[model samples]
Target chain A: MAAHNTVATSNARKQVAAGGWLWGAVRRNGAGYLFLAPWLIGFFCLTLGPALVSLYLSFTNYDLLTTPEFVGMQNYVRMATADPKFIASIRVTLLYVALSVPLKLAFALAVAMVLNRGMRGLPFYRAIFYLPSLLGTSVAIAVLWRQLFAADGMVNSLLAQFGVEGPSWISNPNYSLYTLVVLSVWQFGSPMIIFLAGLRQIPVDMYEAASLDGASPARQFFRITLPLLSPVIFFNVVIQTIEAFKAFTPAFIISGGSGGPINSTLFYTLYLYQEAFSYFRMGYASALAWVLVVLIAVFTAFSFLTTKYWVHYDD
Target chain B: MTDAVHEVPGRASTHPRLTGTVRHVLLIAISFVMIYPILWMLSGSLRPADELFGGDAGLMPSQVTLQAYSDGWFGLQVTFGRFFANSLIIAVLATVGNVLAASLVAFAFARLKFSGQKFWFALMLGTLMLPYHVTLIPQYVMFRSLGWVNTWWPLILPKYFAVDAFFIFLMVQFFRGIPRELDDAARMDGCSPWRIYRKIILPLSMPVLATAAIFSFIWTWEDFFGPLIYISEMSQYTVQLGLRSFIDSSGTSSWNELFAMSLLSLVPIFLIFLFFQRLLIEGIATTGMKR
Candidate 1:
């Protein structure tokens, strides 16, 4: 690894040295860095550098006002053993991701298929559906979600029409998280749009051939559509899984930032926020952030590893 | 000077009319499902709080009034106007910065060849996977140390620096997609590289620029986390942060007023989207599936 790193570094250096008149060319390419400079500066100052700093901070005890004191692996150890909320948060997050991802993808695929059928005013339908996904995870919609799921809100009144009294979805612990799941599923537009595009990319001739083969609609979908769409499905899965794990706004708005009604809706990021800002447990939150990174990386790696068997990239 | 066009289809139609009718019906049904929530939200906003949840039968408002709108605009904590202004300023600034900065970087990435070009590009791509949460606390701490909190600096400054690699990457792809022949032709006509970019490339990239502008505007306007962490001063709050504060405060929420405000929040986004919905959808859908 060291030898490879050195070789790559030396090769880079030699290229730099050999390019004497290439300075003009280098400056042009360097201008790209200039365009990218602000982002690079931000990455170092705001994101990347901070990420490394946070990892270090996780091994220390630090609040905003005071200097950080090195505490070794105590934060991690304590979180693993003593933190009940930590454990509960993990369960809640996994459940949220697991429920939200498949439902969102399925809904998106179904809707995309519906829209793919040579619909009139296709743009209008696409905009309307995609609007929610664009605005869905926002604090405004989360606020709207709270009102829509309140005890005497629109949902309960609709339920009353069926003579099935509905619980206050956001306020009630039993149903609060379910409202969030519904919220996630509602924003299925982004993936739906992608699926629609992917569907369009699939040759119409193939479907025509399937029909000629006397294949039923269901049979054609199962054999042809499913196999071809596997890559898109896998892409949506990875992206949605990452997104769901980071979901914070809804739980915050619905539970009033307490992660309340017995911590049923305490998502991992919310818990992390509570630790960092609310409880002043910056070290713990830092540790939690790192853990989330690991979790996401591991899952992402696992998906990539398994993609050879499942994901059908045409190329 | 009149030209007449005529179509002659002489029994060449093969697809069934029943299939077309069935497809239309399915489409209408699908559209209804998509539109219902937004329609519900809109209708609900026009009613009084009590009437909003009155029943399924009264889904439409009985006395559609501007009371909620006025109350939303003036009476409440996040009195719509200030938040709107804040959101507008942030969004416009972010859009301007992204367009100017991302375009320059994208030009470099697409057109320029230099040492470590591939490595730098890969680095940018690699950084895309680093979730914002990992950097949230430390950024807060860093900003706090610099006393940049309770201000828009944390939100706005980072954006100017091209912190959003997504936009950079998006613009890069767009820039790459443009024909290189235009640059060569411009150069042959004695244009500088900068002149080539400004005169030729930029003019042709209007659609992509518009796409980027719309996205940056919406994303910045809707952003919650950055503002939430950085801005503690109620007066300094962006629209999203202000809206959140409304939910955070107890006993202050008039459901009708909140819904009305929510609707108001969506107006600019809605209008922008309506005007460019086709382009936005196509742009997002195509770019998304590419990866």
Candidate 2:
């Protein structure tokens, strides 16, 4: 038993002596890697592997059934020079991001401000507002949207009662995209919730002091509210812009997955899905996908770059 | 929040600027618009078919019927029950996969002093912004080759490997909030790191875990795109897919029955939202910290 103990001690000392810092780290941090194994495996195999494969696939002329053949810059060239629907999709998405983000933010802030005033049944009111965000992108909601905007649907019925004429919102090229924009804006609960959290962080004394100084409510809002909430607003802008860029389901379902009514609602992802699945042009779709990522990255970078000008964190 | 209380101790949060009837009136009106569609849908689903489009649209249907519910039960090649089962199996398994795997990976990042931790954390964050579409076709091809297409494997299995970076980031944030003293005390007692995690970390972190589970269930339940791309078999269709199959907007769709089934599909998420709104809202609020 003593000999066994001495052997064990000697082995431990040898392990301590061996490989110096590397082995020490391996022993110390091995559990971390073990814990991280699932994520690491996923990071490499699912995310990085697929990402790299798509990058390579973007340069190939692969259909789903055929082996991808190297085609260099052909896909990129076609996307930039040949695809009009591509340009239209980009335009629609950009217009969407431009219109929806500000409106949604404005609407969300307005509601959040009202709710912030210690309303009765605050939780219930908050829940009612938030219900749209939860249901906004669901298949049910999309279906409901299609019907509600149809010429004979409830919206038109409501308009008839008001003695105003309404177009078939989904089928009219002019109004098709705006219908989606409204739906997107309607889900403003997310940002509203976040805004509420940000509002909670603001010191109410600032408002009280400003009021005591005879500053108008508008003056206090401009001086105090906007600056303090800028970071949260920035957060909302970045997230919503990215979300707008990726808007797919409502367009897919409502516009019948073809982004019809003159391609006005052809969100980028919807078009990409068709290119890959419908046409089986996986390579072209891959190129479109890369362009989307680059577009999002550029916008995100732009937001971050401009944030210092507007988002005051030091207060 | 403290300042709000300090300034208006008498009435917790009422703003002095906004007062009485007018504010409530405007709020009630806007609230009506916000909630109108759902109320309309609930009523529409319950209404008789002829009454659906006629007269003023109101929640009061002259006469209601259960016909839509029964017919929509097996309206397609499969039944709504099958779709519900499919969704339930996928969601429950996914919730389990996400909660366990995310918490495990989170434990590594939050507690263990590992090399390349910051790099990996940033990489994880990068994945949060990486839209699933960029990875969609390639994953489809991969899963197609592996014979995972039409099976729930493609939708369900990646979750087991902690592929959802959002959930991991959430869990990481949560694990960081847990005190380290329990870990230290456990280590001093000659407990393995795994023991520290399983015995101490898991028990105390129930609220965050509950948040993750609740979210995973709802998101998976509502997930339209993943299943849309992956599964084509009617037998394998999730609730969203089943609901979509009922919709042929340009064709003959049983609108009343579709509404009934849609309402049925919504019940789980609505229930989840109703019961767990506080946790869900708080979880999302903290996660909005990520951006």
Candidate 3:
């Protein structure tokens, strides 16, 4: 764009640089693509190529020990009709995502609102709250989560002080998914920080005007804060939803990689891993992967579709 | 509780000071819940076996000792020293690879006019949402076929090709914020596009590059699944896999030792976060999504 004022069109100039032919056009962006070569190689060989291969693999019966044998949709059909574990993993993942995202976002926004009140030691509190999200997904943290949710672990010990007995959180099927949800909500720092940034962007005068009009704090939140903060909320929802869908390590580590307690903690990625590697069901895993992609695509489509009804951007 | 105190009959108050006090107290309590587990680990790592499972969930150990630290460091066959070097090597290389490749590609995306720009950008972003498991087996097979399994190559190479689209996207957002006037000025002085990028754009981007570097190092250091699937040799394990091995070998008896090593594993990332906190937080905050 440096030469933009001198030339009417940079594209025409770029075309002319390599002698004005289709080959010239191809050669023109060579430097740009050269800068992009690593990503381009990765995009093809790593992402899109394997993505297509996985799609093909989904339709075949391939164990790592043998060359893929064409199966023609049997994997998907089995997943839909016969594979109980696959169905269980999907149910677990949906429940986890549905429960975790809203809870995390709500906790995040509430704390963000509190931190936005100009308290002392703002950075200190923000950092402390954010510390969990930083380390939450680590194998160590997941292992600690296992211990914390054990029958005689700290969670139950604390519950005992209140004169109440607690169930074994991780080993109990009815309670296992909820423990993961609590873990998800515990790492509310990323969205909380983002919400803090958004909260700061909202003009002080908007609140002042509402206050002058005699709006209660709750009223002002609905009238002014919700509308202004909707875009940030939307971003957090989409990202966290995708993240919750992809959660693996906690369930893997907590369940000791068997997705047990009767498959209570069988997250989708964990199940896919078990299929591909543990059971050597590579074909089945690939099909499960594609099904997940479609599920996420539907959710993402819903997010975008619902935006017009609620999300408002002044720009 | 403080709200009731604010309703005193005689004194007229206007600062909203009472609510602020209540807010601070509530925030402090919540922050305790957020931070207590980490502190518990720190304390539990120091305590003897008898005190660890006791009903008291205090952040202070009854008997403070560095015995667990020494035991954990030397407990594994390969030693924590080996794990440390392996983690540092992988993290440093991956950081270098990601910063170089992401910056170059980000420059092209942000500054240069290219064909199919929209499609390529979308493709890169689309990769961000792509479940890594979709590409997991094929990549494993590809790397295994190349004889790179059980080594660092599979873990570190894709990073060189900007496989982590998040870093490139972050850098692109940073590069976009640089004024085009700077590029124009550099060009007027007979600079080529590469020279302009090197002289002007690169100088203005240290914060973002640092942000990317810190994130890369932490993530690579913390990565478990990549090494779990690829690196199987005992001597080649990173710190994360080493910690997992600790648990696998002695499930319940080595709680104090596991806690000690886990805390030690977190130190590198914690220190990096401590030093570069502002850049990383502001990077994510200002990196197009929030703004």
Residue pairs in collision within model 3: none
Ranking by TM-score: 2, 3, 1
Put down candidate 3 lDDT per residue, B1-291, tens digits, no spaces.
877665542222444577678888998999888888778888888988666474656677878998889989998899988999999999999999999989988998998877988889998988888878888888887888898989999889899999999999999988998999998888789887788778899989998899889888888988888998888888999998998888888786878888889899999878977998887678667752321
- Candidate 1 chain B least-lDDT 10 residues: B3-12
Local accuracy of candidate 1 as per-residue lDDT tens digits, B156-191: 877777777787788888888888888888778888
Per-prediction backbone clash count: 3, 0, 0
**Over 4 Å off in model 1, which ranges?**
A1-32, B1-23, B49-57, B188-190, B249-253, B289-291
| Prediction 3 global C-alpha lDDT | 0.86
Off by over 4 Å in 3: A1-27, B1-15, B288-291
* The candidate that achieves the highest DockQ relative to the unseen native structure: 2
Q: What order do candidates take by DockQ, descending?
A: 2, 3, 1
lDDT of 2 by residue, B1-291 (tens): 886656644443464435655667777888899888878888888877666463355677788888878977878879889999999999999999999999999999998988889999999989999987778889999999999999999888899989988888887887888898888988999999899889988898898999989888888888898998889999999999988888863142468788888888889888988898999788767777221
User: What lDDT tens digits, residue by residue, belong to model 3 across residues A1-315?
Assistant: 657766756666876765666676666687688788889998999888988998899999988878999999899899999989988999999999999999999999999998895778899888888888888778888877877888877788888899878888989999999999999999998898899999999999888777656678899999888899999999999999988999988888888888889999999999898888878888888998899899988999999999999997879
lDDT of each: 0.79, 0.86, 0.86
Better of 1 and 2 by TM-score: 2
* Superposition error at A49 for model 3 (Å): 1.0
